[model samples]
Target chain A: MTYCIGMRIDRGLVFMSDTRTSAGVDNFATSKKMFTWCTPGERVVTIMTAGNLATTQAMISLLEERSKSQEERDPSILRQSTMFQVARLVGSTLKEVIADSSPNGQTSDDQFSASVIVGGQIGEGRPTVYLVYPQGNFIEITDDTPFFQIGETKYGKPILVRTYDKEMSFEEAIKLLLVSFDSTVKSNLSVGLPFDLMVYETDSFDTSRQKRIEQDDPVYQSISTGWGDALRDAFQLLPSYSV
Target chain B: MTYCIGMRIDRGLVFMSDTRTSAGVDNFATSKKMFTWCTPGERVVTIMTAGNLATTQAMISLLEERSKSQEERDPSILRQSTMFQVARLVGSTLKEVIADSSPNGQTSDDQFSASVIVGGQIGEGRPTVYLVYPQGNFIEITDDTPFFQIGETKYGKPILVRTYDKEMSFEEAIKLLLVSFDSTVKSNLSVGLPFDLMVYETDSFDTSRQKRIEQDDPVYQSISTGWGDALRDAFQLLPSYSV
Candidate 1:
C-alpha cells in the first residue's frame, strides 16, 4: 500500500508521497512515486501514483518514453497551456498503460487500476491540484476542500479537515502536511519513509522548494514528539466523570 | 455507518460508539449501539454492535428477551461463569439471530452481517475484551493489539495507534478515545455526534463512569479546539525545506 497527499492553497501546492511498496509481509521494497515533468519556463507537472506497483511503474515508464519522443507526448503536459489539460494527459496515459498491460478482451476495469495526484502550474493562472481516479476521470480541489489524499488517507484526514485553510501561507501548509503524514506513518506499517515532499509556490511555475523527508530527520522527530505530548496534555485537561 | 471503539486497559475497559445510522445520506436516524447487562455485584457485560442495524438490534432484542424470562435468564450473560463464556454466548446468539433473519438458501454474503465487542468481568478474573465476528467466533485483545474498533475505524485509527498504551491510566484512555472519536467525526460524515462513552475500572464490577458527549458539549469543545491548535503548532515546528 501507499499514502499520497496533495494540497492547493493560496500560496501554491504541496505534494507528498511515501516510498514503501510491499507485495506481502515478506517481500518489501522501496519505489519513488513522485515524478516530475518540467520544461523549465514552459510548465511544471508533478505526478504521484498509488496502487499496484507494476501498473503505476508501467504508466510512469510510458509517460517518460512519450516525453522523450516529441510526437507521442499528447496534448503534452509539458506543452499544455492549462493545468486541466495536464490532468487529462496524465489520466489518458494511465488508462492507456493499463489497457496495454492486460490480456486481450479484458476491459479497462479488470486490467488497470491506479490513481494519481497531479499538481503544478502552467502560464499565469493559480496552481491546481487534481485527484485522478482509476477510470480516467478527475476532480479539482476547491476552496472548501483545499486538499486531496489517496492511499491510507483516513488516518491523516482529521488534521486536514479541521485545520486546512485555502489562504494559509506556504510554510503553514507544508507544516500541516508533515503532521498529517506523521499521523499516517504512525498508524500504518505499509506506508514508510523517506518521503517525497514538494512545495510549489504560487506563480513560480517551478518546484523551487522540494525535499525528501527521512525517518530520522530532526523536523519529523519534533513533529511526532510534540504532537504526542500535546495530545497527552490535552487529554489530561478534559474533565473526567465522577460517578 | 457507525464508529465504535473498545479499549482494554489495566484500569478496566473503555467503550464508545456513535449513534448515527443511515441507509443513505437521505435516510439518517439515531439509534443506540451500546448495551449493558449487569447483575450488580455478580457480573457486568457490555456489548457494542456495528454493521446491519436490523441484525444487531434483533440479536440484542433476542438476548434481552431471553434474559427477562425466568428459566433462560439464569444461564445467559447474567449467569455465565467466565468472560469467555459470555463472549461465546454473544457470538452464538449473533449467529442464531442472523440465521433466523435471512433464510440459509437465499442469504447473500453480507445479508445479516454483525460484529460485536464484548468485555467485562465475572467471578474473580481480570477484565477481558473479545471481538466477536459474524461467524460466531471471536479473538481476544492481546497485549500487542489492545484495542478493537468496528465500523468506520480507519478514520480514527491514527490517534489510537499513536497514543494507546497497555498501562495507560483510565483517565488517559478516555481522553485518547475522545480525540480518536473527534478525528473520526471530522473525517467521515456517516459517523456523527452524541457519542456514547462508558468506562469501567478493574475489579469495580460496575459502570463507574459513563457519559453521552453531545455536539456542543463543553469538554468536547475543548478537545476539538485544543487538538486542532496542537496539531498546527506541531506542524509549524517542523524544519522548512531549502528553496
Candidate 2:
C-alpha cells in the first residue's frame, strides 16, 4: 500500500508521497516512490507510483537506462520535449513491462499494476499533471479536476475535491496537499512516513522547493496539530441539534 | 453508493448515513440506508448499508420482515439479547438475501457484498460499534480502532482515524463525523446530500438527537464552509519554502 498525491495549482505543481511499502503485515518496509528526472532549466519531470513495487522499480530502471544510453532511444524522457509526450513514453514503457512479465496475458493482481501522477513543465507552456493509469494510458488534470492521486487515494480525496483550485497560490496549494496527505497518514497503516514533497514553480524547470518529512519533523508535527485543533474549533462553531 | 459512519465513544455511540442511492450518475434516487430496530428502553440497534442497491434494499426488507413476523423467527433482531447476536442476525439475513439474489454461488468478487456498521448499547453494557462483513462475521471497535465506516469509506476515513477518541465528547464526535462525511460527499459523486444523523447517549435508549441534513441546511453549510476555510487557514499558517 502507498499514498501519492499530485496537484497542479496556478503557481506550478505540488507532489507528495509516503515511502511505506508492505507485502503483508509482517513484510512491511519503506521505499521512495518519488523519482525525478531533471535537465535543469529545460525539463523537470517527477513521477510518483503506487502498486507493484517490482514493476515500478523496473520502469524506473528503464527510464534511467534510457537516460544513460541516449543511443537506441525511441523518444526517451530526455528526448521528449513535452510533458504530454513524456507521459506517453512512460505509459508505453509500463505497458511493455506488464506484457513481458506476464506472457499468458493473465496479469497478477500484484503484477505490474501501477498508477502514476506525472507532473512538470517542459518548455514555456503551463505546468501540468497527468494521472497515468495502470494500463499505460493517462488523463491530464484540467481546471475542473485539477488534482490526481494514486494509491490509498480515498483517504486524501475529500480534501482535494473540496479545496483544489486552478488559481491557488503555491503556498496555499502545498498546505492543502499536506492536510490531504495528513488525512491519509492518519487513516491508513499501509501508508506511513517519511513523506517526500516537491513544489515546482511554473516555467522554472527545476524543483523550487523539496523536503523530506520524517515522523518527528517539527513542521509536519505543527501542521498536523494545528489542523486537528482548527477542525475541532470549527466543528464546535457549527449548530448542534435543536430537535 | 452510500456513506455511513459509526463511532464508539466513551459517552455513547453516534451513527450517520447519507440516504442517496444511484445506479449511475443519471438514475439518481433516494432510500433510507439508516435502519433502527429499537425496543426503546431495552435496546437500540442501527444498521447502515452500502453497495448493490438491490441487495442492500432486499437485505433490509428481509430484516424488517423478520422483525415483524411471529412464526419464522429463529433469530430476529428484536429477539437478539446481545449486540453480537444482533450482528449475527443481520449478517445471516444478508447472506440469505445474497443467496436468493445471486443465481450463481458466491465467488470471490461475484458475491453480493454489503458492508454494515452496527452500533448500539444493549442493557447495562457499554455502547459498542461493530463492522459486519459480507461473510456474516464482524469485529468490535477497540481503542486502536474506535470507529467503523461502510460504503465510500475512504474519503472520510482520515478524520475519524486521526481525531477520534474514547474520551471525545458527543459534540466533538458529531463535528469530527461531519467533517469526515463532508470529505466523502465532495470526493464521490455517488455519495450525496440529505444526510441522516443519529446520536445516542449511553443510558438513554431514546435517540438523544436525530436530524436530517439537506444540501442547503444552514448547519451543514456552516460545516462545509468552516472546514474549507479552517483548512485554508491552517495551510497558510505552515512555514513556506526558505530555499
Candidate 3:
C-alpha cells in the first residue's frame, strides 16, 4: 500500500509520496517513490509511483539508463517537448517494464500493475500533473480536477477535495498536503514516513525545493499534533444536531 | 456503492447509512439500507448493508420472512439471546441468500458479495456493534475499534478515528456522522442522501431518536456547510512548512 498525491495549483505544482512498500504485513520496506529528472531552465519532471515495487524500480532505472544518452530506442524525459509527452513516455515505459517481467506474457495479475503520477513544467508550458494508469494511458489535471492521488487514496481525499484552492500559496499547499498525508498515515499502517515532497513553481523548469520528512521531523510533528488538536476543536464547534 | 457507519460509544450505539444505490453511474436510485428489528424494551437490532443491493435486499427479506413465524426454516433475530447471535443469524442468512442466488455452486464472482454492520442492544446485553462479512464470519467492535464502516468507507474514516470519543453525547455522535456522510456524498457520486440515522442510547431498549436526513435538511445543511468552512479555517491555522 502507498499514498501519493500531486496537485496543479495556480502558482505551481506539488507532489508528495509515502516511502513505505509492503508485500504483506511482515515484508515491508522503505523505498523512495519520488524520482526526479531535470535539465535546468528547460524541463523538470517528478514522477511518483505506486504498486509493484520491482516494476516501478525497473521503470525508473530503465528510464534513467535510456535517458542518459538518447538513442532511437530510448529518449530523455528532459528532452520531452511538453509535459504531455513526458507523461506518455513514462506511461509507455511503465507498461513496457511490467510486460517484460510478467510471466507467460500475461499482465493479468495485479502484482504487475502500477500507477504513476507525473507532474512538472517544460520550457514555457504550464506546470501540470498527470496520473498515468497501468495500461500506459494518462490524464492531465485540469481546474475541475486540480489534483491526482493514487494508492490508499480514500482516507486522505476528503480534506483535499474540501480545502483545495486554485490560488493558495505554495506554503498553504504544502501544509494541506501534510495534513492529508498525516490523515492517511494514521489510518493505514502500510503508508508511513518518511514522506517525499517536491514544490515546483510554475515555469521554473528547475527542481530545487524538495525535502524528505522523517518521522521525528519537528516541523512535521508540530503539524500533525496541531492538526489533530484543531480537528477536535473544530469538531466541537459544530452545531449540535437536534431531534 | 454505499456508505454506512456504525459507532459504539459510551452513551450507546449509532448507525448511519446512505440510501442512494447505483449499479453504475447511470442507474442510481434511492433504496433504504438501514433495517431495524426491534421488540422495544427487549432487543433493538439495526442492520446496515452495503455492496450487491440484490444480495443484501434478498438476505434481509429472507431473514424477515423466516423470522416472522419461525416454524423451522429460520430463527428470529429478535429472540436471539445476544447481539452476537443476532449478528450470526444475519451473517448466515446473508451467506445463504447469496449462495442460493449464485448460478454456480462456487461464489467466484464479487457480484454476489455484500457486507453488513449490525448494531444494537439485546435485553441486558451491552450495546455493541458487529461487522458481518459476506463469508458468514463476523468481527465484534472493541474499544480499540470503536466503529465499523462498510463499503466506500475510506473517505469518511479518518474523521471518525480522530474525533471519536467514548463519552461524547449522542448529539455529538450524530453531528460527527453527518459530517462523515456529507464528505462521502461530495466525493463519491454513488453515495448520497437521504441518510438514515439511528441513535440507540445504552439500555434504552428503544429507538426514538431515529431520523432520515434529506439533502436539504436545515441541520444537515448547516453541518455540511459548516464542516467545509471549518476545515478550510483549520487548514489556514496550521503552521506553514518552511523549506
Candidate 4:
C-alpha cells in the first residue's frame, strides 16, 4: 500500500508520496513512487502512483523509455502539449501496462491494477491535478475538490479536508501535506517515511523545489512531533460531554 | 456500511455507534446498531454491530427472542455467566444468522457476514470487551488494545489513536468518542448521526447512562464546530516547511 497526495493551491501544486512497498507484511522495501519529467520552461510533469508496485513501475518505465527514444516519442509524456494531454497519455499507458500484466484484460480491481496522480504545468497553462483510475479514466481537480489522494487515503483525509486552504503559500501547503502524511504513517504500517515531495510553482516549469524527506529530516521531525502535541491540545480544549 | 466503537477505559466501557445503514448509496435509512441486555445489580452487556444489516438485525432478534422465552433461555445472552460467555453467545448467534442467510454455510467475507463488539460486566467479573469475528470466534480486548472499531474505521482512527487514555473520565471519553464520530461523519456518507452512546461504569451493573445524540444535539454541535476551529488553529501553529 502507498499514500500519495497531489494538491493544487493558489501558489501552485504540491505533491507528496510514501516510498514503502510490501508484497506481504514480512517482505517490505522502499521504492520511489514519485516520477517527474520536465522540459524546463516548456512543461513540467509529475506523477505519483499507488497499487501494484509492478504495474506502477512498468507504467513509469514505459513512459521513461518512450520519452528517450525518438521512434516512440509520438506517445511520450514529455511530448504532450498540455497537462490534459499528459493525463490522457498516462491513463492509456497505465491501462496498457495493466492489460499486459493480466492474462485477461484488466479489471479495475485486478491485482495488477494501479492508480496515478498526475499534476504540473505546461507552457502558458494553469497548474492542475488529475486522479487517474486503474480503468484508465481520470478526473481533474476542481475548486470544489482541489486535491487528489490515492492509496491508503482514509487515515490522512480528515486533516486535508479540514485544513486545506486554496490560497495557502507553498510552505504552508508543504506543512499541510506533511501533517497529513504523518497522520497516515502513524496509523498505518504500510505507509512510512522517507517521503518524496515536489512543489511546482505555477508557470515555473521547474522541479527544483522537490525534496526527499528522510526519517531524521529536522523539519519533518518537528512537524511530526509538533502535530501530535497540537492535536492533543486541541482535543483537550473541546467541551466535555456530560451524561 | 456503519461505524461503531467499543472502548474500555479505567472508568469502565464506552460505546458509540452510528445509526445510518444503506443497501446502496441512494438507499439509506436509520436503524439502531447498538443493543443492551441487563439484569440490574447483576449484569450488563452491550453489543454494537456492523456489516450486513439483515444479518445483524436477525442476530439481535434471535438473541432478544431467546432471552424472552422461558424454555429457550438456555442459550440466551442475558443468561450468560460472564462477559466472555456473552461474547461467545453473540459470536455464535452472528455466525448462525449469516449461515441462515447464505445458501452456502458462510465465509468470513460473505455478504451476509457481520461483526460484533460486545462488552460489559457480570457478577463479580471485571469489565471487558470482545471483537467477535464473522467466523464465530472472538478476542477479548486487553490493556494494550483497549478499543475496537468496526466498519468504515480508518477515517476516525487517527484521532482515537492519538487521544485515547486509560484513565480518562467518562465525560472526557465521551468527548473523545464524539470527536471520533464527528470525523467519520464528515468524511463518509455511509456513517452518520444520530449516534447512540452507552457508558457503563464497572461493577455498577447499570445501563442508565446511555443517550441518543441527535444530529442537532447542542453539545455535539458545539464539539463539531469547535473541533474544526481547533484543528485550523492547530494547523496554523505548526511550523512552516521551507523549500
Per-residue lDDT tens digits of candidate 1, residues A73-135? 553456678889888878888777777777773364463577899988887867888999877
Model 4, span A119-228: residue lDDT tens: 98888889999999988889999999999999999999999999999998999999999989998999999998999999998888898998999999998999999988
Tens-place lDDT per residue, model 4, B1-243, is 899999999989999999999999989999999998899999998889999988898898888885466765543777878888888888888888888888977875699888999989999999999999999999999999999999999999999999899999999999999999998899989998999999999989899999999999999999999999999999999899988
**Global fold similarity of model 4 (TM-score):** 0.97
lDDT of 1 by residue, B1-243 (tens): 889998898778899999999999999999999998887777788899998899899888877775476665553567678999989999999988787777553244666788999988886988888999998999998888899999998878887877788787776777788888888888788999899988888777787577888889887787777777766665555555343
What is residue B26's positional error in candidate 3, in angstroms?
0.5
Ranking by lDDT: 4, 3, 1, 2
* Model 2 Cα shift for residue B203 (angstroms): 3.3
| Residue pairs with backbone atoms closer than 3 Å in model 3 (clashes) | none
lDDT of 3 by residue, A147-200 (tens): 999999988989999998899999999899999999999888999999999999
Please give the fraction of native interface contacts (Cα pairs under 8 Å between A and B) kept by each candidate.
0.49, 0.47, 0.75, 0.79
lDDT of 3 by residue, B78-177 (tens): 6689988888899889888888877776364558889999989988788999999988889999999999999898888888888999899889999999
Instruction: Name the best candidate (by DockQ).
Output: 4
Model 1: iRMSD? 2.7
When superposed on Cα atoms, how far off is each prediction in RMSD? 3.0, 3.0, 2.4, 1.8
Off by over 4 Å in 4: A66-75, B66-75
* Chain A TM-score values, per prediction: 0.91, 0.92, 0.93, 0.95
For each candidate, the DockQ is: 0.49, 0.49, 0.78, 0.86
* RMSD, candidate 2, Å: 3.0
| Runs with alpha carbons beyond 4 Å of true place in candidate 2 | A66-75, A106-110, A165-169, B66-75, B165-169, B207-209, B241-243
Q: Superposing every Cα of model 4 onto the true structure, what RMSD results?
A: 1.8
